[model samples]
Target: MSIILTVRRIDIEETLNTTPSVLPQIKMTAQLNEDRIWIDGCFDFVHHGHACAMLQARRTSNNKENSMLFCGVHNDAAIEYNKGTLPVMNAPERYAHARSIRWCSAVVEDAPYVTAPEWMDRFGCQYVIHGDDVTLDANGEDCYTIMRKMNRFKMVKRTYGVSTTDIIHRILTHNTLPSTDKDYFPTLDELEFCSKGVDGFSNHCYVFQDDLNNMLVRGGYDWDSTNSVLILGDFDLFHMGHIDQLKKIRNVLEPRRQIIIGVTSNESKEIIMTIKERVLSLLSCSFVDGVIIHPSKDTIENSSHDEKSKFSKVYNIDSPELVDGTVFSGYLTSRTIIARIETQRDMYVERNKRKGMPI
Candidate 1:
């Protein structure tokens, strides 16, 4: 015997403008909710700038409690065709990067470079969000023109002082200034820009708190010492590799085990991002349950007993023991990212120069 299933077709128009009388049942039964917001990008380098856009979109929802921010990552072909250059990270890497963001509810892979209303409709996204900066296609037309014409577009402030271009510029120039140097560190305003919409840590605290002193930034989840796992690392640049490692830890560990991240405040000359920036980056990850900002080597060893007793299992990512074989060995590390730019130094320098960025 064979069984047949009948699926109900939902009218997109009715769902968008549903009244109490018209398709009231359909509204409640619809798989896609009205609070879904769409944001698409190449997300080549996956920096705080991309994270901020998604955060702003989630904050803009009509019902914050139930809002779902769907992130659409464009494929390599689309990026190459529209931007005249292939993305530094491939599509799978880009998708994984977007998936790790705390604000992203879902990841849509292989999205078109140009925003299509049909694609947005298919996801039942009420509005399409993007940064204020204009994105143009190959023919010099606005990428979001279709969404703008339909009045289903929303714009958030573009994060300044940081971009893939700027990162590439720094790599090409080998600008590894000390984190304490005023010129090297991001300004208070720029730091606060990325810290906004973070749940547990206040923007002021996140920006002004001295990482040299020990501090803990808790996630939105409540602490439960009985069911927690501690992982420590510098987490500089917070790329897909970090996300993959966190995912593996989650998979291997017991279900519902909270993964707390311990970020070392190492002022090493090799460190690219500051401790605060690193903390913010880790906090933005969906897998991270909390972040503990600990002082360098000896200081951590001398930490108070009360702080030390919180976790039953501790895994140092720099030298993992518990999840030895499960650790990710991907090519998405900060070193490799810098190397990618270093290998293509002239190309990146010329790209930044064309964008009017200081060489």
Candidate 2:
């Protein structure tokens, strides 16, 4: 597998002269003591990789619990100008998706494509965080050069094996229907790698009965008996459609009722992302309180009644309760995304090739 990594050499003198500093010295000095960090990106097709970056960014602060991560999503025009293509999702949608992540304290929409020291100061962020991969501007220069000069830039390891390009490639190559024959489950090593930044945080990922029971014994799910709204689905890609549904559910439900998601394991279904990946994606959502890894259909049908009574309302992806009445729904499912790629296979294939994916 090809790893995403980039190293850029910068001329300090040139960068300092070219990059404009808009923040007053007094304001900059005053904000230096804040625990806020800024992370900006064109978070199209937001996935686990983006979530991992947010988690790692949150860890940069001296006090993890008190740290605030201000996430910034670039607007459509900026993304198009810099990347040569409009994002899969628009600015508002991307902003909403980024805001859903558990680690994000605030979301800044219409952020500049290039990281600006003034923008960081505007948010009172002590540092700006990004993955190791180099993001270039329309001028073919490192977008973070200015921040690097200001000594306000931080780098996190890029999560290998997944990206929006790779996902689009998968959709182009694979059938939309779920396949039980294909071994798409992640390896133990990969799981361990993704679990790295989550060490000191609350344990949100869980397996079925056995694992969940162990977690409960360790005080993972303290509201097991609470009245909650239950939502179940494959949540394969876990994109904007899923986020919109969760947001709607949260709006309709009482504030005191927790929203728990039951992610169906991939043992019997065809899913693009593994169960652990799905759990991590769901846990990042602001509306999601807990995730329960449930067995396949037969097992779910046979689950004890005591387990069923814990939820006052239950909804699946197909439930009318979650759907907004419209011919053109804002929701985008994994299948819908796959169909989109399939419809434009040649274009996506070329796009992935340009991104250095082996085609």
Candidate 3:
């Protein structure tokens, strides 16, 4: 048999200077070398918007010799300090992800416990670039002074500042809002009406602000342990996972504030729900003040039912009336409604329902 020969060619364009070397990973920075603009961040959740930010930075820097982006990984401690948790992806993983981008020139692991001052001093960075959405003065007054003095700092506008947290919340809400961490809040007053007048937007979502502090005005009825106000949303399929999220929020405001989670209605086209189970899910948490439902028909105007207890307010945000038209039938609802939830989690829930489960 004649021997068959096959040759495979591989092209390695740039250098892999920092990684797969040793322990105590290095702290590296992307510079405006003779030719390229370097973009750096934890880049934990690489996204479409992130890609755009990199592209814009590259164009702005106009590095002739380096036509690519440089990303820097912060040490584990750095990530925890800044983002309040450990990184979703580790160093080596982040390094490889950054390098995979066609625009990226290199990826390196940053040293642990290194401050920006130490980094600037070590890298002798000609210039440091970042996404516009990132806070320039995150460290403190001293950081501003350092960057100002070095004159090596640069920022590119972030076309999409959408964060990883936002993405996660959307996924959770859509797929696991009720089941993720379900908690029930009792209501001071509960009422049922098969009919509701379309409440037009009175823009009644009011936030209570004092001279020095801001607090939510909740009509606490059932919660005794935590004098706090309770706020829940479209808590479909109510599960312990959801309880985890609600309880965390409650713990801070607890004894001061607990939550009265509003279950989403499946009646209208405007409010999409999760699981789409014909049966309504029930919440069973002692900390929960009570559960309440929205009126199918109304006093469309967000008129306060003064005769009824004060706990009545909008429940589901997915309801069109909450964001749009209001009740005009000689009824008026308070412009200040307190159904607060973490903005990030709220976004997550909306995204989840659409993918399949329904929030």
Candidate 4:
């Protein structure tokens, strides 16, 4: 969905109380008496993934008189660890974004870190919402321990690719410095950008892709991804739109989902000139882990499936050596889109997609 720009920063308390453009809308505690929902976070960037979560929360509410909806944001220090630098968007910006989403009835600058069970007990939140992606932490403890405490919890599984970290990356890629030398080899971002049919555009941390053929091995991951999702296309002539799609997919894939983008490699050199490039184009992005050719006979497929899944995924892509406008308008590759739920997450693949781009 294309964004229709509106006001950047506005006071929620002020708008709801005095602005003629806005109306007085108080937290409907009575309406939500039996239904107390909490969205936990510092929500530093407050981008698309946040929006997705809010959308899901609202969906469950159904504008019902019986449901009461609320959201909470973490204080500055709490958010910093997840986001690098100065938490790109501040508390005011974060509140402004959350307020715009009507699903959220209240906003509080919560403490730095509070476990789910603790928070639920403190707020009496009848239902705590989480995305399907939440899982066991490094210590082997499930991330949703508190929510699991009671059946009142609700987990929303939405399409991926909308995330704050992703928004940061898009902002960074939009401002990538001019190419310089070997460093100029295609960027994982560039390959990922091309993979999704390039916009003329554009993470952190904390996830393990150990299964060998992660979400990148196949396809179909929806979320503002920390994990990468692979998209295959000829991508001969890159443009702004192509860039945007990659940003969208990267953000929408599973969290920390690195991308493994595949650019078409012509079978005959007579059709195109030789260009020196790296195995992966985008190396600078914190999100993309690596890149690769459309999958070769020697590549290792995941342990989950015995068939050459990696090669099979690449085989579905349809491409030609030619670079033209029609490719983006409508393009395909000779490879298949592949994803593995467990095998080495899609992130490395996302990073490596940039391997073949011309400087």
Candidate 5:
């Protein structure tokens, strides 16, 4: 789905009601039996590196199937106060980006600079995870010191190739950046601009397109030949039915075909697990080839097998521009389209036809 711009309403009552005292009362009641893995960072310009960290954190739990990853992206104020610079992506944008990541189960809104024990208790997180790279606060104190002393800290190896800081520097010095070093993926905004296509191009646009194509090649996605099918659903209690559906779709798979599953982040009144836990569940199912975080506009129905069975629709995207326009489109590897239909909202499954035809 294309990232549409919208004004997200904020709850004033919840905002003003979050006093320090209220923190204790806001604990995650569900997932008592499941392990919550906590990872916190600025996550300003989320990249492959951040995704790697989240993946590593999810693997730390003893029960891989029962583990949930909760990402705490520091708010804009916290970032500026601690790092002497505001994040390129504001708090909310960063939150959405983190939530959109398949590895992140849930994103904590406006996380504090310090990880309080109350936070650990509230989220039911047993361990605080971070990359091995050291990060100190403005006071020159290790940010994870408290957690480390309490024996609740574990570090994953940092991704070697790129970092957010490196991307920022590249953006600033794109004019003179070396050809061998041209490796940054375009942001959503940049991708949107590229979607305008070459017909809308000029000499300057060609230059930009060349750069984009370079990034796409480096990302190992062949934009021209890849075909993708988007499978939409909540996949909350990922079961045999879900796997069967994937198998049915794969039965009709063509060469170079990719399946993308969009899981609803829509809030549910009777939710048994956090969005993070639900994501982890779907991920464990071998049927899911890719996962997209779909923000639910309305309340989701309860987790009933009958209701889930209705999520058997397959969409044939007709527009090549929507599919191949942006590198971020389609499957994570590349080739893409913007399918706005809610993955769980409609049931347009064609029962007679087994495999999805390319539209």
Candidate 6:
């Protein structure tokens, strides 16, 4: 079966350029004819967990009618005031991340932690979706109580691994050494190992080098045999733009080809995210097959250079080389394509609804 990927685009320049204010206002769209599923939370560091929640929201729609997933992220002040700590990523950063996800159609800026009925009505929301986890306000009251009482809320099963807090803890305790057993670290905040083998790689981070090596040994993937696409970038503040680029690459390559991403750990003054954060973000995306961490700066700069290349010799061929009977080429997507993508996404959703299928 083929996977149907959803995509949404707000004004590209406006979304990128706008600075999210402390008390950002929500500008309601004039066209709210379709069924809208609303997901509200502080979507910081937009990981697999958040993506799964959006998917669940879409599934909950049941494809009976035209539906869109609108996410409402809590502003920085609300998060700090209630949770006693500020989010790792700021409001604008989080907004950009949310806007980039394919499943999310619209975002409600400066969303209140406790959503009101009027708020739901304002967005034409039939269901307000959230994870199974119960969230409490600063006053120790259930934030979603009102929605639950009104039967407008639905809870999706929370993903088992890699939370925003877990990433924060990893960053906070980045200097510690791995334990001898390597099952887990002794620190209060420890990264866990993937025990379920290669299949478990998506859910958890491999803490031990031996564990990862063991998976590689058991899986036995022939690197040179496969036609692979090598993507090299910092991938900081990973968003839909990054995913779109990867998707474009995937569309051109043969299905047998693997997509390996090289995330440079080289520090930059302008980068807001740490190297670990960047690596985890890249790993979370489904399009990526493998990630190379901390590649040498010199090697990354001269990847096309005719020298001792660590990449397989097949990819090391000179300019105008052909791999798997396909010529190596590049593309730069234009702004006009954004509108087409948005239109296509709408058509796809409508078609799925007509067929009684989930998108």
Selected candidate, larger lDDT, 2 vs 4: 2
Query: Model 3 compared with the native: what TM-score?
Result: 0.39
Looking at model 4, how many pairs of residues clash? 84
Model 6: colliding residue pairs: 100-240
C-alpha lDDT score of every prediction, in listed order: 0.65, 0.65, 0.37, 0.38, 0.47, 0.52
Give me candidate 2's TM-score against the actual structure. 0.78
- In order of appearance, the predictions have TM-scores of 0.78, 0.78, 0.39, 0.38, 0.48, 0.51
Which of 1 and 6 is the better model by TM-score? 1
Candidate 1 residue-pair clash tally: 0
lDDT of 5 by residue, 175-223 (tens): 3232234332234333322222111121111111211122211212332
lDDT of 6 at 160: 54
- Candidate 4 stretches with Cα past 4 Å from truth are 1-34, 81-86, 121-123, 135-142, 175-359
Candidate 5: regions farther than 4 A off = 1-34, 175-227, 230-359
Residue pairs in candidate 2 whose N, alpha carbon or C atoms collide under 3 angstroms: none
Per-residue C-alpha lDDT of model 6 across residues 159-258, encoded as one tens digit per residue: 6554665443333333222323342212212112111111223232222121112222121244431255556666654654566556545566434565
**Full-model lDDT, candidate 4:** 0.38
Per-residue lDDT for 139-251 in model 2, tens only? 99999998899888899998776688877766666543343434344444433333332222555333333223433212244555336666788888888778777877777
Better of 1 and 3 by lDDT: 1
Per-residue lDDT for 206-323 in model 4, tens only?
A: 1112223333322223333223344454332222223334444445423344555444445532111111122211221223334444433234232224342332222122222222
Runs off by more than 4 Å, candidate 2: 1-30, 175-221, 265-270, 296-299, 302-310, 325-331
